[model samples]
Target chain A: MTSLRHRIQAAAVAAALAIGALTACSGGGGGSANGPIEYWLWDSAQQPGYQKCADAFQQQNPGLKIHISQYGWDAYWSKLTAGFIADTAPDVFTDHLSKFAQYVDLKVLRPLDDLGPTSDISDGDYQQGLAELWKGQDGKRYGAPKDWDTIAIFYNNAALKAAGVDPSELQNLNWNPTDGGTFEKLVAHLTIDTKGRRGDEAGFDKAHVKTHGLASEGSGGGGWGQTQWSAFAGSAGWQATDKNPWGSRFNLDKPELQNTLSWYFGLVRKGYMPSYEEIGGANAVGTDKQIQSGTAALGLSGSWMISTFTKLTDAAGKKLDIGLAPTPIGPSGKRASMFNGLADSVTTLSKQPENAAKWVKFLSGAECQNIIGQSGVVFPARPAGTDLAIAYNKNERKLDVTPFTQQVKDKTTFLFPVTTNAADIAALMAPRFDAVYIGSSPISSLNKLNNQLNDLFKVAQ
Target chain B: MATATPTQQQASRRKAPTGYRDDTRLALLFILPALIGFAVFMIWPTLRGIYLSFTKFNLLTPPKFNGLDNYIRMVQDPVFWNALKVTLYYVVLNIGLQTVLALVIAVMMQRLTQKTWLRGIVLTPYLVSNVVAAMVFLWILDYQLGIGNTILAGLGLDRLPFLSSDTWVIPTIALINVWRHVGYTALLIFAGLQLIPETVYEAGKIDGASEVRMFRSITIPLLRPILSLVLIITVVGSFQVFDTVAIATRGGPVDSSRVLQFYIYDVAFGRFQFGYASAMSVALLAVLVVITFVQYRLTRAESSDLA
Candidate 1:
């Protein structure tokens, strides 16, 4: 009987410790000039490139050093927030446009304009609209733009060949809310049944698909579905919220968005895509794994996942040949992609704020951007950096990354919604999105959520 | 076996000799560190949490008093209601299955195999973290390519969506947690079983009472205190479940699996609504308190029939 009591006691202790750790300020010994500027990032792929940049940065500023800490996407925000509450936040940390607003709202960010080194970079210095996302409502720069990513489609070459689909047909794939266009047709062809019949063929079995035409995006994609339905909806002249950065209203209630979502989720019904229930589990399988396992023939994904898709191999170690293509042209007569970027911001708690700003400035500059681009991990914020990555991809990786760049070139991209209450908004819409995906809830249910969503955003009377 | 005879006489009735100048002083001195540790780690945080429930604090900003606002919001919030409902469903299912299985296993082990090695083997899953267990099950129970579905397919059976379907997710997660916890629960019950005298069974056999009757009349009646203890502990633990749901479904498939604790976590950490989260936690604490009290009263856990 004491064993049960002991177990309860142990659980209590663990809970207390967890709470204590979150509130405890464990600040480092670092206000000194010679101390390393604490830098944090979430992406491990870009770790080595940033390490190289850190090394170069130290040499350029003699006696100034940079310490880097990396965490995964989920851990990064919680850790950062905890660190902030505890006054132990990193001196400088990479920031996503989607998450940037909350910190600004809390006054935890140190504006870059106050720093001398950051003065050189201007609106024109970075990729289009990248600079504008970092601006607070107070007209201060919260971050220095570093890198950008756009969405595209990753297809398995061997899978396409096995399904007797031509690679060229992928280039001209189109979509609309009325009908799924050539994109759906190609997807259906690639969707083979276990009995060896295509999705478009007679006597095709949707229940036991040998391979799904499209993979799940690993989530309900929150308020916006950049890699899921955003591209299609955007091409249909629909935006997630009424505006970017500080939109008080939502367009989720729009017919364009609903019809677009209906068609997108209808693919699951037709067996072109995996049902949400099939793809959901512990750490749900993303497009990267789905495509690699030959579960999905095509995966619409972000440019940041370029490397992950490229290096996929089966259980037998047979390398998968992944091809890239732009998203299908939708009703607006052109393709669309959600263009988002990451930047570095100096934390208000940073003891060595000036040094942190300098490190952030260096990261934003062409020199470090070029290094990041050369590593072929990400497309750097500067055009020079993008050019380097393009060259590196073409020369070393034998991969053409122009579909991502072409969106930037053609200006057919919209910014990921950047506003406060993002988490509240996401939580509100997520279940509804899941319901729609699982085919249990109607798409028009979004209209109710959309009304509730604006209440959180405090949409103007 | 030693019988647990009534020791009704109070052992703590002696006077404190001249204003606490004897063993009491020494005892207080000896227990001072532990008291301080408990206060700092448990009591202080709990008090702070209660204070926060009445305020509006986002962790970054200083708290502002907002009387009953969070409680009001929670009452009106459909997600909160859904979370509470789902959590109750999960708790009832998990506790019901786990207690039964744990009791059966404990009885079987007591009768057949009392080997320490068997106990250790049974307890293996209890030691594994919820995250690891959830991941292992995810691989085994996955709808698309899991070994479970493969076996089902080989038998010409349709694949079941274990963790993904809204209907299946709650039961699946409950089963996962039950698997992780049943061993430890069984061990606790086994410890209670050891307290039963072997002579009781001998007497029952001599009296021509069946084993099942002996178990029902003697073992169960004698085990009431421990069973009630186990129920209180497991029920409270089940309601506070977060780690498995966090690692697994993450309250998905139309929020069918969003347990109360998970929702509170999302409010605090995910959405930074610490004040509202604190209020929700306070409500959960109150619920657990009432439940424990009710269980104690119903089972008469304070009085033992051992003697």
Candidate 2:
């Protein structure tokens, strides 16, 4: 009996060791040709469009396949970093401008100089400056532009009618930092008190308001004001950094930025916008939901939210009428939108780097891009793809995206500020931005924060 | 079925070396897998973390030796100090409420019914993930639309900015964690209550002692060792508050709730400053060890009245 017990224990230990050895040996990338290329992205909205692309790519290349995985934006980067450390990272993944530079510095991204141009597609085939945006400091193209987005105004139509404002009135609105120009008047006119009084009317109570003119974006869009004050600040001739992509110093202390932010946040004080205390932190209501539910008349958001805004329904599930408009022209006498783009990059740890490059090429090429654009979820980077998206939204969704596309055509679009240490920059700037928005810290704190931001760059050097 | 006489037992004990070495070998074999798991997952990683504290490493890249640079920078970092202060505040509030509430509940359970089903029901919140708890509370405590605020408004009270206000955010989070953790802590104390013999209470009852007096004199003294253990676990867990803050606020409203663990994660994943993050982690580990030692000594956890 004793011998039998000892034998069983030894067998159990042997089984455990065998299982451990097997687990340890699996899940490695080998740069081999046999395995399927793993492709990952974070946007659930674009998953179907890419799935279609994947099907087409598989038919084109027999015996080769692509496995696509999607994670939420918050979990995506952390998971990818863990995958990289484990040497089990996806072969090809959707890359963001904010993070791609860091990945490149870490030498995890495979520069696409060898495969920059396929037979039918070239770098020049993409939207102007987009392909260049993915180039590393070494002048090697690390990714190919997949799609682009710009910011726009989404308004609730019923609210405008109740305020006695015309839709055309928003088409060419001009704004200034000092007085907020005609935009403030428009915003104020749309706001209503709990007693059916307009914000601009006599006996209008700032407290106990029924509807705000504009909805808050929680932490007021954090440091990246692309959806909030970027248009106003950019049109005011304020730049975030001395130069983008690789700026040595930040220009957040400039008067144009300071004045623009002050006016933007001052709307909260006037009760034309939700105060940070009213809508901030983890439980804050989203701007889109606020507009749909009549909490606010309108909101500024990225063009990618066009479908989301257009599909807003009330609590009773009744579809509400909505309108899209361009950002108000600022003090620079021109309207501006921040143009940000996404791209696909091949990883250095890919088991099938060549196949991953092929997949990236297909994603960037006009054929797959056009397929993606026809989905009308996002604007493709290629010009033809962009045209297809506009047509698709207009014909199928009955939503005109010309307000967004026109900025790109009119050269009124500024690039999203690209820089190294992007996450560090966001960390240093976000809390300070929140502080000012919450009215706990003065706006002057921004100037001091910028010095700290510049110091980060200096230390990096 | 026959019992051995003392003479026969002594004769057997003196015979054939008693096979004690064989039994010891079998015991070691049974526990070897657990030892291997501990070495691989816990001890190895801890040692590696200490080594990484003195080096610069991004997850994707090889670590570079940087000497004491990381520790030096950590010493001067105001954010680190702020995180430490915030974590200590959270620990005090969370542990204080959790311990007191748990003790009261445990006493009630001990005095009333000793039902397993009730204990299981009490521990339901602990079964829920921290992220799930935080997310649910976010909706429950929303100043505008949440049912919690709706109740307040219905009662003719102003809505509280539970998470939005920096002054309220930490306390709100502490309360949320206390709600999730107090039940499990109560069960631990309840188990401790079970170990105290019924004779001590019977004797007090025979002496005509009041329930309060009996509880104070008999129950409290016997429960000290268990209470000490519970405090150490709860305090350590409270100090490492990350998931709740991460999912709910992400250390927002001017860093009011940026607990030490959350700050370490941000420094590592957010900024890719792994070296600095590890250095901060080492400091945190040192603090926890000291705290644990002090708690053990203060509570006299080594001694128990029942023993």
Candidate 3:
């Protein structure tokens, strides 16, 4: 009788374990037949707008459901890579043109050519050289342009006013390596040390700075592509792989590249900007903290950060006033901004290709873009949608968002290289920049970078 | 006639009972789920990965195998060599540091019976995941806000570059890896240390043996088995070091810190050369196997002599 009882108990335990495993496989809100499609996005700042789009899309398709997952950018990429390997990539995802080449090369993304023709998007409808950014090596489009972002200077108007300088004069500040240009004067005037000295004063101690004049700089260091070390490539006229779209040869050997690196490093060597050690914390935190704390007078960032800064009420609930300007021109005698844009991509692993395509089209459509534009999450890629962005910034946010859009029109922007080997190249570049920023290496080491870049690209080609 | 009846009964039993069918059914029922699991998760997927490696199979399109091409290209790849050299360095450094530090700590902890809580606290870092440990280290190594620079400055010294210099980046990251993993390894050694029976040391004391002499004679011999196991595990684990390099240095500063795993990553994801990456993986596995085998042989030789 006891043996029989033990057998019965063992059977029950096995059955219970089986039931749990089955439940794990079949459970979850999106797993049921005719359930909603799951969408994952990185930016929490843009979640509400995305939800708004989802609601509108669901209104059109009553049977379909949309589940959205949000993570920080770093976590998002990490999760996406794991998911891609698992064959569980999202049905649709936001793709950056710069890094999309890697995914395209991996063959993880579904080309939209099968869905429809390029006629839906006319060259005339979008900014010049912008819409074509999403095309892969085979002349097939992978991602549809979602938004455009450019580098801009964000300063504190209150700080400038207190320093008895006109903030408006910094609109097109002439700059050189030797003299910080008009920026030098503005920063010097604005920077008030505890002993009533300024950064430009003769006896000012750069080592023990009481108040800094500038924010963070260098690549893998801070700012966007322009503020980062990659912009030095543009300043020195060094493209990662020399040529358009995808170059067969690397151009790291260019003298201009080395000059750009050295000159940019001079910013830290000369006490103009914070060293790598000083800028050491979170990627976006340092500039925001420096500007907010009133220890630093000027910071460089994009318009996206305006919402982040202005919303931060002090301990007493006082709102911070943020100002904007274009990125200072490098030594090239021509100011070039690094242009980055997001793309809407469909996943080949997705079971519901039609539904996924529809969702992708809807998200890139003007209606959804307008909703996103109004939220100030990104600079809308569409011409009509961007107008909404401008109006929203001017009327709702009471801040000018034109400089970023103007960069789209001016053609002064260098889109980050989109190639199959971009990720490998970036992996190669990030650490060298880290080295220079930390003061352990000289910027002239960029010469070595040029050679390595050439070798890396040669293999890829 | 009775013998004939017994033979008839044996013949009937030899023909097999109907209850044996139920045993077959039970065996099938027990294995069905596991068979399905292997089909879905392991066997099917491995075959797919192998096929995909041969082809220019980006995840987006149907796979088209290019055959031995990826393997051929990998032989000539410069980054591959660089990555191999870097990874070898990391493995050697991580194994050397972890073993030395773990052994030292284990020996120390064994001597300090009064501070039992300290032993538990020392192992806390190993309990934490690599991701969390990396983030904590990032803060500690932060140039301005980090305690590293602050402490140095307080001591009237200039700040040292922990992550930037090509010369120092690998060592600093290796040090961090050692610090994080030493505690777990030390615990293993401590368990081995405990197994060294008090009787052996007591016997040595009766013989007028010094503490150092006793340790050399008994403790070292007894601990060989554990030390060898730890060495093999540590070496294998160090060879596969990915998270620390990815999080800390990211194989940067002119690829000074780039390891073999990072190379495989670049090949697999960055270049979409899965076949090449797989080949690299296979090569690494062979190296690990050899190292483990040698360690096992050495340990077995020492252990058998004592027996």
Candidate 4:
């Protein structure tokens, strides 16, 4: 029995060794003979549009194939970083412009200068500031313009009407760099819960109030970063970086940013927005959820959310009536929106660089931008694409997409500062943002965070 | 007859060789593979880590020797100090709670003369994966629509921020550790209980000693060896409580849940500072080794007294 036990153990060890060897040897690149190039994207919502693009591309080139995969934005970066470390990143991948500088620094992407017919897609056709965001520090293009999103105020028309406020009268509320404009009035006018208490009323208990006037799901970081607090930085005309024209050095400790976060969180404290405790779940209650449920009369989000929130109905099975407008002005008279744009990039490790470049160029082309515009997810990076999106939203979806186009054209759109260490700096700031939101840290502490960020970036240099 | 007698004498001489020599050869053959595995996997890796801890290696490019620069920076890093304080707090809280609960359960099991199946039921949770356990706990602690908070609200009390608050995060993580390991530690002590001779208990009872007295005098002393073993295991496990904190909080609410391992993960994977992360890991290993050695000496002295 003892000898048999020994034999069994030996056999098990041999089997494990064999399996490990096989896996180590076989699990790598170099499979299939010139098959489809792998393309990775983060948005499941955009998968159908990408599929459409793929079908068109495949028809154009028979031997060329496109293998597309999707991941949530958070997991996408982790996987991308791991793939880069392993020398096995996807041949073609999608990335946000704020994230471009870090990867460019790492030299993980191939410059587009070597790709064919680069002059065919003029930079002027796309949003100029956004198109310029993807240029590496070396002044070489690393991404082709895909789509752009800018922050906006999304309000429930039904809630406004019931509260006796004419939503139209509140259009283009103005403020200077010193005083917060009609933001305070609009929030009060639109806010009425089932108990019929206004936020401005004396008896209103901010802590116990059942419904809020507005709420925002703050996700901080480069790619997943949103305009919860950054908009205030833009309104104050703060820049996060200066090397690249689009690079941002978030003046996080600046009076403008502090004032913005303080007021934002104050809304929660004053019963104008949902409490951090109230909205806590596996996934936080977002602007979309707030507006769709009529729990919040107003929400701060972007145009892409219009498609998502427009489809959501209330518990009573009533469809929500939503409208989009520019973000409220800070003390500065300038209305501001945090601008974000995305670009398609080809990996330096791609087996088929030519095929990958063609796909990227095609996506950035006028024809594809027109299709994206019609789908109404985002304003096409191209000017012609924006017109198509507006027409499509008006004719097909029957909603006003013109507000987005108008906002961008009016120059309220502000781009985030890009830096070589933007990703690291954003990671550093995310926790601080949460602290400010929870009332755990003082608003002035943002300066300390900013100083630390400069120190980290200086060390990297 | 003379030739046959000579051949038989030669055979007897060959067969009479000592069995100890053959036994030693067999033992060496059986242990050689394990020895080789230990050298390659543990000793070599440990030495390499010690060397690499002094260098700056990001895994993308070749490593550069930076002398003690990484270590010097670590000394000044506030986050590192914070992580260390948090880790020590976690270890103390987790081990104290787990050891007490495990001892109680173990004594209860030893006292039981019926229902052997109860042991299986008690041990079931220990077999569950940390991921599944963390997910269950996460759902329970979720601020909205979670059962724990809902129950609190139903009882007319304000809901506690089980995970969202900075103060409660570490305690909640420690609770998870206690829940997962209490049963397994109990079983280890129970095994120690079984090893106590029936004669010793009979002798105590014969002298008209009470049940509690017998436990205090005989059972407690006999169980020290195994208890020390369990203590060491729990301490080491608590020191490296990474998975629960990772799955539960990802070191959020302003890094309240940040422990040494989580800090290392953030530096290595999150920010791509692999060299700094390696230095942190090397420091953690050194701390663990010193604690383990001290434990060995203490337990050895106590066990010698038992003998």
Candidate 5:
């Protein structure tokens, strides 16, 4: 019996070894000779649109293929960094302003200046400020502009009407640092308690809010709250940094920014908005779901969420009427929105650099941008493509997304901060912001966090 | 065959050279593959990690030797201190609750006459993936929309903040850990219980001893070894808790649930501070080793005392 057991165990070991060898040998390496361009992106919402562009690119270049891999926002960065360490990174990938600075410093990204038709792609061809956003510290372009997004107020028209507020009244709402101006009044008027009292009413129960007047994203504030509170802070004249890409000092400790945060969290206390516990909790749903379920009247969202809002339905199975309005003007007498964009970058490790560069060129060119615009997932970075997207949303979805486009045209947009060590800045600020949102710590806590962030920035310098 | 005297036969048995040598060689050959795997995967990585702890590595750039810099930084980091405290709190709560619950469940299961299938049903939680289990619990514990909150509201009680409050996050995580792992712990204890002879219980009854007395004298003494093993296992497992916290709390609401492992992950991946993370990991390893050694000594002393 012992001899038989030994023989069986030996046989099993041998079989496992053979299987492992076969599996390892069968695995193909990425970006090898004749291998397809390994492209990666984070936005699954825009994957189908890009897949269509890939199909066209394949037809135009006949033997070359582009394989697209999509990951969620957090997983994408983590896995991409791992891929870089393992020397198995994608040949072409979509890059973000927040991360591209670090990538440029690492020298893992190829400069687009010497690549295919990069010179032909002039500054005016794309949306204003987008082409500039992709430049590294060395004054070399690292990415080709793909799409841009700006913040806006997405309101439930039915909820607004129920509260006896006109949709156009939302368009002209202005905000101040102290009272929040007409915007605060509108939010309070729209807010309803379980006892059927408005937020502004004396008998309104703060403990049992049935529907919030406004919903921002979850309260884990990083360096900035782009779509959540940046519109308020930026309009109140709080710049994220002293300068663009390579700025060594962060402006988070500024009083204007702190006041905006205080007032935003104060809405939670008054039951005009959801608390951090409700919004950032494990069971929390997105802003779109909140509006669809009659839990929130307005959501401060980005233009990228236009399609998601358009598809929402109420409890009666009727499509909810979604309205878009510009962000409230603040004490500076101007409205502001965070203008962020995505770009396609070629990896320095690509086996076929020329091929990868050509693919990026096609992806960011006018033809693909028009195709992407028709999908209405986001506004293309090209001005012509932006108009096409506006037209598509109006004609097909019957939704007006002009508020987002108008931010770009009217120049009321502030660029999302581009800096090295952004990830460190975010990690240090998140918990502090969480404390402020939950009312455990005062807004002055940001002063200390800003100091830590500046210290990290100094290391980058 | 020839008959031999007792001494001669004993000598011949001891001198069975060919068969003994062959058996020893075959046994060594059988274990060679496993030994190779351990050296390549486990031992090599451990040595590499130790080396990395003394260097500055961002992964994109090649590592540069910066002796003790990473360790020095860890000593001064307030976040590191917070993480260590959170990790210890998690370990204590998780191990304490799970150990008591598991023992109780094992005793109950042993007493059960019918429902043999119930053992398998209880183990279903252990079979579910960690990520899947976390997601289910997240939904179940949601403040407004969760079933737990709904039940709380129905009972006319305020909704408990499971993942959103600093005070409750660690306990909530510990509860989830207990729920997921108690079945496995129970099974181990139950296996030990089965190994206890039925005749011992009969003897105890014959002596007119009470059930509690028999359990204390016979069962507890005999079950010492298994209990010690379970204690060590639980301690090690609880110290390394990460997945549930990552999915549920994300070390948020002011870093209340930021255990050491999650902190290491954030520093390495979020901040790209690989060398610093390695140093922190080494520190954690030292803690685990000391804890395991202390448990080992305690168990050995108990067993010796029984002997």
Candidate 6:
């Protein structure tokens, strides 16, 4: 019995030693001096364009290397935050307007105001309000504006023609909080039941929709559905906050916002849009996929998705006839879109902060922006780059994306809310919005949630 | 040529201190690497985490001592309470379903002890990565285009909202957890069954005892230790479920499925409230400790009674 006990203890000791060796093998030390400057981004579609810029930058500056990594949106943030905790964060990364505020507050970002290349960039080089959005509460810039995106309506021309509606009618669509105006009527007209009847007809089946008028993930302006209903809500005079970048008070409880949400989700009940259950599942089809398959006539999307929508084809290998139109005008007598931009930020923990800043400047400069514009993946922040992107889309993809540009030119764009507690605010409001989309709660429920969100803001302050 | 008595041998053993020293040194050499690693990776981190629970840390800045503020806030936080409730519900649902199902399978496998390949087939789900299994289940349970709803539609029944509705999301996630873990759990119980000597059962049979009666009186009492182990592990694992919830529902439909671990993750990484998250983690550890102690005592009392 004593010998048996000794054997068991030996076996356990062996197992523990093995686990220790494995753990020792897995962990790595901090960044080295000669290591490549690590860059991280979320959008896979824009990777190739940035890779081109990285290659050019390396050729120009010898002995310097850049390694770019891309991940999907949700995993990107989780991994990036974990990297920060482990002190293995990328030297430079693409920053979002919604997320940079927290990074600035955490003091993880290197201020760009004193950087040589960033200081060389003139205010007029970027589009209006693009450069200012990267500044923190200390009035120091933390990022270099790379590109901007605006919301627009992506329509399937074939589906529009099949519904007997003129394609031009979509261009002039207008909306109001009460009746939804002509835009809602157009949506009802585009909707078709399984029995081949339009949604406007009395005999239409709401349960069996063959083609939905609008393709949405059903969060209705909640959880970064900026392109989905923000345009409608913005045009209805519902700002996310009274002032962005540091707005302590959220404007979600405004009656105009409530009315907009009620009318927007009412489309789901009317069978003109997909229900939250249908389109909000983990494996639910994306908006672009629905448009390509003729399941949805129109998808409210950002200019960043233009290339993805254009490349979609039908089952017969025929190209999907995609058209871009400006968002519908709301009751405030003007169209509006959330003018959001992404910027490249250098981390303060970078071993080579100067090199990282140099990479960011090159990536955000007009030279690289123009190259990115030619790829037609997104509208570059520079005006000249935007012009090049519009021409490239027209000439190469045969798709016109001027409607997105028009939002910027006509001054119908609103800044995305830039609060320090953006994630907490979203956490408080997302479920409430989900309740609204699921028809389990009224739109007025947001008033209560808004109060809760404001309480969070108060705590944050 | 007479052999030494037991006491004489023990006295000689104690006198040879060199032999004892050699054995002690060998044992220390075997365990020193592991001890060093545990101190570095486990003990240090645990101590640091406990310290962080009393501070304010945002990962980028140095942690500042915040006294009991994080604990006070956690007590008042509605989301933390919601997460705790959801986690408890998940624990009950998953542990209740999985333990019963695993025991049944283990008993059946014991009857068919010759079929060793069945064990491998059953364990395949446990071998699969949790994230991969979650993604596969997400595809299968998709509300519109999933095989689950497709089959329901084909059977002339209304489609169930497996991943979307607040009412069904947690239960569905619990079912997925059961599917992935039941096989391994059954294997552990089967191993425990193998350890129970057959002679006792044979004696019961000779006494004209029925199989059901023998199983009830003998098998159950003998399986208590393994059953306790499985229950405690399942309870602890169910409380910390994050990957499946994250990949499937993202605690959606109004945070109905937001378990404690996922809430801690959202607070730590998403909101950058590391200190608060650490406090929540400490609270979770306390809850697990209490639960495990109760289980240990209950199982010990039952086994002692049987002995």
Off by over 4 Å in 2: A1-32, A116-121, A220-223, A282-284, B1-31
- Which residue pairs collide, candidate 1? none
lDDT of 4 by residue, A1-461 (tens): 32223232332222222112222332223213376777888878778887888888889878888888887876787777777766657778998765777777677788887778453556787886877777787878888889888877778888788778777765666433333457766775566644777877767666555557776675343232364656665666655554445344446666766666666677766677776556652136678777775667877777767678777788888777777766666566676776778889988778778778888888898878887877777788898888887887788667876556666788877675666776677667777777777787888987888888778756776
Regions of model 4 farther than 4 Å from truth: A1-33, A117-121, A174-180, A188-196, A219-225, A242-250, A281-283, A291-295, A316-318, B1-25, B113-117, B205-215, B301-307
Tens-digit per-residue lDDT, A44-88, candidate 1? 988999999999998999989888889888878878887887766
* DockQ of each two-chain model: 0.44, 0.32, 0.13, 0.20, 0.30, 0.32
Count of clashes, each model: 0, 0, 12, 16, 0, 0
lDDT of each residue in A125-148, candidate 5, tens digit only: 888999999988888999999999
Compute the interface RMSD for each candidate structure: 3.6, 10.8, 12.4, 9.2, 10.0, 8.3
lDDT of 3 by residue, A1-461 (tens): 32223232322222222122222332211222255676777768878988999999999988887788887776676566656655656777877665677777767788887775322654455556767888887988887777777777778777777767686786777555556567666666666555767767788666665456777744553122445555445644556656668765656556666565666666666565666545642232356777776657787665556667667554576887777777666667656667777777876667776677777777878888899888876777787877877887788768886656666676767876666667666666666666666666677776787677677756655
Q: What TM-score number comes out for model 4?
A: 0.88
For model 3, state the Cα shift of residue A162 in Å.
6.0
**Shift of residue B135 alpha carbon in model 2, Å:** 1.6
Q: Relative to the true interface, what fraction of contacts does candidate 3 keep?
A: 0.17
TM-score comparison, 5 vs 6, better candidate: 5
Best by DockQ: 1
lDDT of 2 at B282: 76
TM-score of chain B of 4: 0.89
> How many collisions between residues are there in candidate 1?
0
Q: How do the residues B251-276 of candidate 6 rate in per-residue lDDT, one tens digit apiece? A: 88677888888888777777877788
Model 5 misplaced regions, further than 4 Å: A1-29, A117-119, A282-284, B1-23, B301-307
Task: Say which candidate scores most in TM-score.
Answer: 1
Candidate number with the higher lDDT (4 or 6): 6
RMSD in angstroms, all models?
A: 3.9, 6.6, 8.9, 7.0, 5.9, 5.1
Could you give the TM-score of chain B for each candidate, in order? 0.93, 0.92, 0.80, 0.89, 0.91, 0.91
